[model samples]
Target: MSDKNREGKRTARERMLAERAEDEARGRRRKKLIVGGVALAVIAAAVVTGVVVQDQRSKPETPAAAPAGTIGDKNLIVPVGSDNAPSVLTVYEDPRCPACGIFEREFSPTISQLEDAGKIFTNYHIVSFIDRAVPGKGSKYAANALGCAQDAGHFRDYHDVLYRNQPDETNDAFGDKAVLINLGRQVDGLVTPSFEACVNDLEFSGWVSAVQQDFDKSNFKSTPTVLLNGQPIYPKFNNEEITPANLVKWVDAANQGKQVGTPGTHGQSPAPTSTASEPNNPSPKAG
Candidate 1:
């Protein structure tokens, strides 16, 4: 055989091998695409299933819908800890009040922990004072939004979202209608349609007005007020008791838990123990 022919044969073999390599590469790409698609489908299924499970869990088990016309009040209890909890705490807060925000962030956890353990039951009365901007207008919209959240049975989440995202108290837009709407979206079971409608309804205005009236008639002049049972959990100092840690001090002191030694705070020794059993005010409790 000629040398040229031999060389040509070798070249042909190399070309064929190259083609096979290309084919293998193409096959691998196809397999990769198939695997990626399967993985995506699995992830999608898992997400959907998770959402469904969460929905099932949040649905009212017995469904004793809050009675109609119960706009507010009637021990709207948020279980903090024990049914044997010594007292109910009623907090009147301004969504726009910085002090209130501090209290919500600082003290709420202690109360929440206690509630979860049945040691405390709490009620929240949205005071809507100092609406960040408008003298009275701020609370109106925010309070309306709270009412909407309550109607949706996701008030707890909405309430948390509000305090979690609260802006400075003197500002006007903190709890604006739009802010309320976005906050509603953050909650799992919140109904956007109903929230929008309910927030705008004038029917809930009375409830808001009533809450504010109650505060106006109270012992304290300003907000971030804590009424333990019927007695005020008045702070010894500034609204420093507004922060999460300090708020816990307030609850612990109110509950006689250890004196949490955070700076600028102290625990009050349980109301003299002999001060005739404190009576808690009647208000709507948290979820």
Candidate 2:
């Protein structure tokens, strides 16, 4: 009786061990299947990405044409005033710069007045240095769009609009070509096929790079860097108010002793010969 019971218990234990081994094998097989599935998915994704990249590389490249009115040695400067004006206001700016936006909003009108009066010429050195500092392509793309607008004879308009519609500091909406093209339509005569193509094709990307190269090589420290007759003007004048009146006063001060339009000279000066230049030197209002 004891042998029979012992044999039955031993057989039962053997069967339990065999069943556990089979279960363990099934678990290993399931795990291998899952790992293999994940590996296949990752490989498939890599293949798709490589194909897309290769396709893009295989396409013909269309370099953008140089826009009209590019000045300076590298042809990167966008001039927006009389070449013969008494003073030149050179500004190094990045489209993504918040400070640049503020300067444009506050002093652009005065710049327009001075430009219209033939009192001063405005030179805009657009750059994309922020692309290296920031995480997106907005700075480069927006500057490229401005280059296209320059060719359309609407640089100033488009430039102002870009600043006015500038996205939040964290946003990179300007990176989108469609957004850039849509902004161009607001300026009359800026919505043509060439302008659209220029914005979309990144035609001025090389030009943008050159401009940034010039900027990097310059002595300027930041965007909205303003220079009057090659003399650097501080961004914040008299307690952080860079108003139009302040701009006028600064220009007057810069030209204090020199004759109007004299380059690099200092001191008070008379007005230009043109009657349109009469209001160019408006006295800064008493604060």
Q: TM-score for all predictions? A: 0.55, 0.66
Error of 1 at 8 (Å): 99
> Candidate 1: worst 10 consecutive residues by lDDT?
262-271
lDDT for 142 in candidate 2 is 96
lDDT over C-alpha atoms for residue 80 of model 1 = 22
C-alpha lDDT score of every prediction, in listed order: 0.53, 0.69
Which one wins on lDDT? Answer: 2
Tens-digit lDDT string for candidate 2 (135-233):
689988999999888877788888988988998644789999999999877887788988888889888888887777665555454566776665556
**How big is the positional error of residue 220 in model 1, measured in Å on the Cα after superposition?**
2.5
Q: How accurate is candidate 1 locally (lDDT)?
A: 0.53
Clashes of each: 31, 8
Top-TM-score structure, candidate number: 2
